[model samples]
Target: MDPRCIPEKFFDIKETEVLVTRITGGNVRNALQDIHVADALFDLDELAIIHHTDCGTLTWTEEIIRSKVKSFAGKEHWAEIDKTVYGAVADLDEGVRGDVKWVRAHPLITEKLKKGTQGFVFDIESGKVRKIDV
Candidate 1:
């Protein structure tokens, strides 16, 4: 759902609560690289790693992006970007499960597993959210 489409009253979030999203492949790297998100998860009651079908990030391979980066920013920057894959996945259901596993394995995230984690795939065509088992 476009979260903003619903009024805040529909959910419990308020005051110290927050609703956050990582739109890029729904990668857990955001929490790994960003300390604030890592810290905040401790307070989270649950973490839902959401992804959808036909996401654009799955359009290109890391090698392709690396080659383009080299073409645009010269060899140095491309080398810096190196082997970093942006976690793109062509299979939507597997992708969601993979993200759930990724979050589960992250060091800080593992510490907060008691807070619950799940995967979901939002079907754009059906306007439905289907849960995925990780």
Candidate 2:
């Protein structure tokens, strides 16, 4: 997570007021397990999938990231590594929409949660977050 991309400050919210499941590219695919757990436990009011401008994931392809990791983690773990989603992003708007759509369609996320799900793009330059209608 980027130090400058703090949702609390960006949203003008208190630290304990929100439950954030932050991940690279803000991909809901990577946060499904956490979403499921939270859905089952908490009465979450909203699910905001926030992707930002100039994310590192935008700089490289998934294959390129995997190749670099393979060089360091060794081929022995390639199976697991290959299975992982590196979350390489292209367009910020498209990324947010895809994640929101994916999460809303996921069977594990409750219907209530899905209905409440929303997408956003955090403009790193402007320090602002805008909602994306899917």
Candidate 3:
């Protein structure tokens, strides 16, 4: 969750309207539950998965992070962490596209929400959000 990537400043929308669920690499796979919760509670009009350039996840591999975790958190914790997807995204555009597709394909996500689900890449350097056509 980068502090620079403020949704309201970039999107020019009121804070109350947007449900910003920030996750590592902006992986929608990790956000399915949040979407489900939002869907159950509110009338969600659209869903946007925004990944950013030069993300922290791009810097490390699963093996490296697992090793670090194993060293710090112990073998049992490492094994559990290894079973999880740490959301290490290699390519920003591909990550956004993949997340969008994953979110859209999920059976639990409502049809209307799936239709409205869009992917975008926030350029940390340029301070711009570019929509990725999936």
Candidate 4:
């Protein structure tokens, strides 16, 4: 499934176990660390890291994006806009790999969780999801 579509559709089911985490500053590892620390009570069977094609987040550098926004809006708004853009531009593959790596490498999750973690790449054009060998 498309990563962008997951929240609106996959997460809509009431029975689904969802932990909505928004990691800012484009730091995937830091975000997962926070989740691991906070969500110890829940039973996490598998981790799904989804990335899509044609994602606007992948385009543009932090400085350029901020400058463009500031040009249109104002200099005072650059900081907030830069932070938001960075958060969204957090690479999907990197985020997924970091999360799974953390789960497998960390003593906390590895000790309690028996299921192995994996990553996937979703192609929006072909509508196919393939396992990513990282």
Candidate 5:
């Protein structure tokens, strides 16, 4: 996770106030690896999904990565990576919508967190975060 994205300074929050995890959008949207979070945040209140401009996940689509990996990293390597979702986003608003939808719909997260959910778009150049209305 980039400090610039959810910086402690963003809300004048102390360092201990947040726990950041850097993952592909697919992980968020598909709810692949959230068991630990469900346990850890059992007493949590809210959640936020922040997708940013110029993310590496946006550099390549899952289809493109699937097609090219064999040639670039060999067949075995491609097989290992094939199961993963690239989590690429071509449109920020729509991507945020899908991510927020999934998060809201996730069975584990829905029950674990009870208060609020928000999505955001961070402008890499401006170092600004804007809320996306879901």
Candidate 6:
């Protein structure tokens, strides 16, 4: 499911335009570049970076995960699963911090999305959302 497509009960806005992209191999920089180009062409307002809990991408290192998948699935699946798990330890605070830092540091998105843009970490256990300090 697209993270942007998820319903927000408390958070209200005029409208939202969803840019659904397949993010694989942990290449967030390239993905943000594509989104940044689209945003510039369209004149977007704000950007939100969302990383969910229990995401499979956080499970293993790129090499280990790829080898396992290749052994079970096929060699073709290696490229798509080559995502390094930097800080996917299920800590809400740490995850949010890492994600926000990554988005803010991205060259394509940094200028467009300044302090106005923000990062949020959602806790499924407590049903709460908190802003992350990048």
- Each prediction's total of clashing residue pairs, residues at least 3 apart in sequence or on different chains, is 0, 0, 0, 0, 0, 0
| Alpha carbon lDDT at 72, candidate 3 | 76
Candidate that would win on TM-score: 3
Query: All predictions: root-mean-square deviation over Cα?
Result: 4.0, 1.4, 1.3, 5.6, 3.2, 4.7
- What lDDT score goes with residue 6 in model 6? 47
**Higher TM-score: candidate 2 or 6?**
2
1-134 per-residue lDDT for model 2 (tens digits): 86778788788787677788777878788887887677668877688888888898899898998888899996789999998778888888999899888987887777888898899999999998888989
Q: Which rank order by lDDT, best down to worst?
A: 2, 3, 5, 1, 4, 6
Give candidate 1 misplaced runs (Cα > 4 Å). Answer: 1-18, 33-38
lDDT of the structure predicted as candidate 1: 0.63
Q: Which run of 10 residues does model 6 get worst, by summed lDDT? A: 1-10
Q: Model 4, residue 9: what's the lDDT? A: 46
Which of 3 and 4 is the better model by lDDT? 3
Whose TM-score is higher: candidate 1's or candidate 2's?
2
lDDT (C-alpha) at residue 38 in model 5: 50
TM-score for model 5? 0.73
In order, candidate lDDTs are 0.63, 0.84, 0.84, 0.56, 0.67, 0.55
Candidate 3 is scored at a TM of 0.92
Instruction: Name the 10 consecutive residues with the lowest summed lDDT in model 5.
Output: 26-35
Candidate 5 lDDT tens digits, 91-124: 8778888877777786766464523767888787
Clashing pairs in 5: none
The alpha-carbon lDDT assigned to residue 40 of candidate 2 equals 69
Q: lDDT score, residue 69, model 5?
A: 65
Query: How high a TM-score does candidate 4 get?
Result: 0.52
What stretches of model 5 exceed 4 Å from their correct place?
1-6, 9-11, 25-27, 30-35, 38-42, 72-83, 112-115
Tens digit of per-residue lDDT, candidate 3, span 41-106: 996879988988878988988888777777878665766988977888778888888888897788
